[model samples]
Target: MIKFLVLCLIFLFLPFQAATRKQILIGEINHELKNLSALKIVVFKPTISEETEYASMVIQAFRNYFVKKLAFDLKDRENISIEVILITDKEGKGQIIEQKEDQGQGTVFFGKSKQEIKSSFFNKEGIQIYPTRSSSLKENLELPSLLEAQSDSVLFLLDFDNTIVLRDDQYRGQGEHLKPLEYKIKELLGISYPKILPEETSINIGDKAPNILLEGRKLSDYQGMILVLTFYPAAYSGIFDTSLITKRISEHHLSMMSCAMHITSFDGLSSKIGGLGVGYFAVSESTPEILANWKEVLETYHIQYINNPDYSLSKSFGSYNSNGYNKRVCVIIDKKGYDILPISIMINDYKLGKKKEIQEIVEKLMINI
Candidate 1:
């Protein structure tokens, strides 16, 4: 896998850059989006209270939140707009702004001023509140009135209430709210950006398979029998059956047997490698430790493993938790202790083809070996 820092291609602002400058950074927003979505759609307090510090973190969180959600909807969204606002009140309880989604275009929102926010907050009489377009406030304020008073030129409203929280607030506000613009931008760009894939950290056809300690055992234990070493994420018992596993077996010769190794622990038990209704070997190390050992083996072959660990091995692996598991993978270890070939597979969700898949994998392994 290619590993290079994303060079921020900033077009130097000449004497006069474009009338408006647009800078974009792409990333995966899955983590941020999940975090935000899990929380109740309401106002959250900032850790920092100083005007600038509070504003900055709030803006970033908002950007991270919205951009992540937006990108999730449109995976191709690489850029988003982030605007900042500074509002003040006797009490600094932030107002919750509502969000609305565009038809695959992106998202937009409006920010409120100090007076506007205070009026809205009191009108609703709730500290944790989300403002809405039609919310009736003591000042007879409306969405347009709030938008007009915002300091920022443009803002992206996530419309969380409309999109997710489908309920009205008790009084002046709504339950779902819009995050700030900058936060939304980062999240959107992050979510839209594709994650880096994992690399194959195992030996291949022509390379020597490195020896290692496997649960107080050595990697050389299975040197003679055609070693079918499979690595799967622990929680994927459903999809890791015949088809996804066996499809890769078709490439090998007959006489080779396969074994499945789940890398994740079950119910906090000590890590054990199990296959064929038996415990092959169990390593107690955390996932990171196991991956480090795998990396050494791959690098010895002058090959780079895809670091994705999110999808197929593809001779590349990484710490990415794609599908909540390491990349679904399998490897053929030759009698002489060489990794003859590696195959990456993806298990479709809830597609109950496990029985057929397992059967096909075994047949393919028997035939190809």
Candidate 2:
């Protein structure tokens, strides 16, 4: 009878012990972050083993959330830094086993924030807890406005079973749960969310190049020469550097055509090119602010500009995106006015800083020209 009573006591005490251990682990994580003053974003993943596939999914979700929803270029680490921590359970103790940095690429569509960015973790009950802030403190004192809380950093706690999965029986990582977390982070950063428009069908290889009006002439007018159409958001948007691309084109002596999403002046024409013209898609009915941002680029590279107030030109080529800007792509049209090179090939080559492949394609097409 005494043994039976002791067994019941042990079972009741087990849950309490587990809860205590969890709280201890949470304390340790918070202490670790407090010691690291430089880390702006910290992600904590707790696991029973070394495997971190679910943790990776969480990171990818954050990347997609920020890039797709907020338009934040995660690659701009100059303004933000992230650290991912892996906490492993060994013999009932939580230990931080690994740490690494991530770039999180995408551009900031809204204005940049000077506030320190942070992440929050969900508790066992799925309630988000900001580790740096005290829970007992008054709400106003604990949760200050984003601009007022410049020094505070957020931490994220991810558990494979509880935080990542929707059901205990399911294993897939659903990103829908991350929306609230993303909005909280955005609010903390003091940045407004911008509406993203839908993307249109893009131009494909072998399709006849759209005969859109370019200045006074049509796209077919350049049928005798191979045309390279490079589409970008705008000049110096930090999304893509058109100046570097133009320099590469000039060095390779490839005939080039550039497109933007705003009004631009095209007075400079380079004599070195087989053909050169800049086309722009208007963002609004009224003339948007003209920076003449590319005028220097034009004079320096001898590139010409053409204005197309119509967004159809961008849509026809599959360069239009929801951000009222052109998707970064380089489409190659053969001298016969048929798209000979896919945008993927050109974009991939440019990203790798290898213009040789594109130059080779242009040379081969020039043979037929």
Candidate 3:
């Protein structure tokens, strides 16, 4: 009876003991491999879960985000790779398993429980483990430690919304949720850029204007001609009514010099002003959808449309917004290719239908030029 009771106790405690043993093995492996130069990202794939597809989507989204963010510069960093594991509740539930027999080399593990895996990847020296609730995962994820672990080439165990099991694509979330993590990774990799530039140092008047590619032609190709560059939000946002502005500006014969003048419009078909010296050109980001939508209007106006798809032109001119639109500002470039305006002149507001302000500004600038 005593032996039978002891055996029963061992059976009850066997799972716990195995779990503890796996935890120790993971710690030892992490300690042994923390200083290696190869960095691997381990994602656990659940063998039995109704949300398996959702988890796969999340993984793909993460992979896509990482590739889109880092692929351009990843060629220089050959030490990074992603590995997926088919993890089950029994054998590898919360343990670090090696990919090969070569110890201290290759992929690591992403434990099922947060407490089971104490990350040595982000710590300067030795592993630091913290107990955390799944809801407060982001707060307790030790982002600062991640930033500090810049020198260590180690694997990352990413948990999406506190669980490896996601319900659906919508529940998987978007890249915005992972943006903070992405930014930290980029910073650690030394490839992060500032979100916003200082106004004083950004593009300003009197500075040599940055060159722009309009369609196949470079802005430099239009040198010696006074360029009236209009940056607008979209084809027809009502903030800057292209039709009215074009008509107003064309009425003044701003392009009478045959110097290749450009005007952007939303509703009107491209048409040449009769015997007018003004050359009407419209510039926009070149995309198939935009081109298709604006085809009829562009044809009606007879306007030369230039493609600025990346918005590099608008951004260089300080007219771009982070929300993927250009500000309603008109930039006047002199014949010498310098931004001649001391201040951005406000055009018509569609709400008020005012047109005189832009007319006056353009007329005045033309006279001075």
Candidate 4:
């Protein structure tokens, strides 16, 4: 009996990778996420202070990235509404414009607050704080009263409403035109800023993570590992910059565990790429010559590439990289194999190159994670 008690205690204390998710569902004892496929999000139409094509692009880009790529079930409903109210000093109060979309069957979205698992994920609205041209308002540069958010516990974000409004409104005056507007994401979301939006898990600390692999190495092999997985599209013009990526990785002797996606355009401008395995890229249509340039890049940079399992897109494993957004950003995944997957995304500009920053972030993440 004493021996039996000791055995039971040992079993109880062991960190079972599959145990945390066990109680979530009967059949999904091994599944890390609990019915996350049914998340219903309402993307409120965005309001911009000064109307421009960029604002429209940002809004639509966010919406499509959420609904289509991230696989959220976004639909219009009467239960909640997030009306983007842009109080600009330009010329008008704000305009309400509606766009339509189809709803997909996505899973439940939830988050924990204080302690209890509460549904923090809700329909989103935005309030952009910008110093408009101010045909009537004050001329001296300052945060106008028109900039304060009118909130009823509504989730808000910094220039989440306007990415460039910061540049045009305040930064240009300050002479910081080319920086990403770093808003108080915490103040806006009332929480830590997510590299990826709608981080929908209750416990991430020690929960067993779902497997994310590249080439042939299974993530399970690194059960206790935390890696910085960067996704790059071979077709991006930036990928050709050998000094930026190849030289940096070689100098740092970083792990070469990466994957490349082949894109084939149905139309001359639109294309389809991978969503499967451990990757996502934002790309547009390109010719066979550009696709073949991966070899040239490898040879020139002396960068080694990993080969992944040949899988079909119909296998429900990959996604679409629309509008060349993949070329705009690099995905840095924190694959804590036996826990939640935390990501640190870095936007890449072919001109400015992210080598130094990427290397620093990777080293920091490697140490901390």
lDDT of 1 by residue, 1-369 (tens): 123222333434442353232211111111233223222232222211222122322332233233233212343433333222122222334443333221121211124333342222122111122222222321221112222121221122333221211221211110012211222333433542334334434333445444543344454665434333334332111111233324534543222222121222110111221233222221111123223323221111221122222233323322223223333333433343244323222222212223245334434443444
Model 3 residue 341 CA deviation in Å: 10
TM-score of each: 0.23, 0.35, 0.33, 0.25
lDDT of each: 0.27, 0.36, 0.35, 0.28
User: Candidate 3, residues 1-369: lDDT per residue as tens digits?
Assistant: 999999999999999775433211122223443333322233223311222223322332343334322221445445443222222212222343212211121111122222222121111111122222132322332212222111111124323211121111112212222333443444445653335333222465556666656556665666445455555543311111234445645577442211011233322212312112223344444333333323332233454444555667667767665644444444545543343323333332121122244444445555554
Determine the C-alpha RMSD for candidate 3 after optimal superposition of all C-alphas: 20.5
Preferred candidate (lDDT higher): 3 or 4: 3
lDDT of 4 at 207: 39
Model 2 worst lDDT run, 10 consecutive residues: 116-125
Best by TM-score: 2
Worst 10-residue lDDT window, candidate 4: 171-180
Error of 3 at 56 (Å): 37
Q: Write model 4 residue lDDT over 1-369, tens digit each, in one string.
A: 999999998887776533321221211211222233322221112223213212332332223232222211123222222222233333324443433222222311212222121111122233223233343213222223333322111111213222212112321101011111212222233332213222122222233434554434564554444433322332222122233344545565443212221111111011121112223222222223322333332232222233221211101122212211122234345554335455454333222234456546555555654
Tell me the deviation in Å of residue 224 in model 1: 6.0
Candidate 1: worst-modelled 10 consecutive residues by lDDT:
170-179
Query: What's the distance in Å from true for residue 34, model 3?
Result: 46
